[model samples]
Target: MLFPVALALIVFATSVLSGVFGMAGGLVLLGALLALMPVAAAIAVHGAVQTVANGARAWFSRAYIDWRSLGYICAGIGIAAALLLALRYRPDLATVCIVIGLTPLLVWIPRRWLALDASRPLHGVLCGIVGGGLNLAVGVAGPSIDIFFIRTAIDRRRIIATKAAAQVVSHLAKVVFYGGLVQAMTGADWWLVLVAAPFAILGTQAGYLLLQRLTDQRFREWTRWIVSVIGIFYLGRGLTLLLGA
Candidate 1:
């Protein structure tokens, strides 16, 4: 009972964080879930919860979503999902953690090298392909997807909305990849995810409200530092576990 309650709280808190910042919340949630559950199960549950969070975020920011880009990104996501399904890859805690930990480094890449813009059809497809595969592999891809948008001329809200829209597809692909393709989720896992859904929605709403208060400059700055810190912690944790293993 206490465990479920705690998990729900984490879901709510992280969703709110995601709602405001657009990406860090999922990274934090995936790490917490990975710590508590098996890698496959953790990714599956994270997918379900984030599906709701990102879906709601997309809806909230629907006015700003670049629908054309989302369509192309979805195409790339389908390709990536099919490729991952064909490989029948399995996930382990250490590797997944390492992958997740390394993703934030994308935020620090030289701006010139990251000229990828999601609004461009080809770039959107690439974002979907790489970001979707990474999301399936590690259960999160906030920073990876952010690279494409960070270089774009879009405003903060569009970045948040479009990313949320793209992530909805990516996260759904993850849920299917791990939950159905990998056959990882149990009935109890589904139940917990369902219970956490409402809380996620609430958190997203709260975060969206808060997002209205932040400046574009502050949004980008905070996203970089926060994700970097989280990435460093997870990197250390993964290394320690890998060494022990």
Candidate 2:
């Protein structure tokens, strides 16, 4: 009872955070879910719920999407997905938690130095491979993918929309890859995904409305600090778990 209720709250809040800042929500969601369930189950559930949340965000911001970049990124994601299946990689919970917890810190990377050219298909593909693999492993690759978007020709709206679009594919791939692992779960687990996904959409809508009121610079400034704090938390928790193990 308490688990489902807590999950609902986490899903809503994190979705809003993703909606407003264009990322970070999944990191929080994964971190919280990890505490309540087995790593594989938590990842599978997160993948399913995030698939809906990102899909909704993409659809809502469909008009702003950058098609060319999205295409190349998708190609990369496909490759990564294929590679994952071939590898049969199954990460341990403590390691997965550390990776997820540290994800938000990618926000602070100096874009000026990296200047990843997303205009090139190879770059998008490269990001896709990295982001896609990371998504499967950790459940969210927003900050990793965000690095590719920085300094791109697309404006803020396009970045957010296109990234959301890319995430739709990323999360869906994650679900397909992780989905089979969860088939044995009780009906309650499916209920968690069903309930959490919709709440995530609602939270996203609320966040979108709030986003309209803020400037791009302001949005970046505010979300960065909050996400960093969350990153620190995951880092602490994950390390503690790993060491204790």
Which number leads on TM-score? Answer: 1
lDDT of 2 by residue, 68-176 (tens): 9989999999999899889887767777768866777778987677868666888999889989889988777857887887778776677878888888898888878
* 32-77: candidate 1 lDDT, tens digit per residue: 8888888888888899899999999999999999899899889889
Count clashing pairs, candidate 2.
Answer: 0
Worst 10 residues of 2 by lDDT: 178-187
Model 1, runs deviating above 4 Å: 181-184
**Model 1 vs. true fold: TM:** 0.96
RMSD of each: 1.2, 1.6
lDDT leader? 1
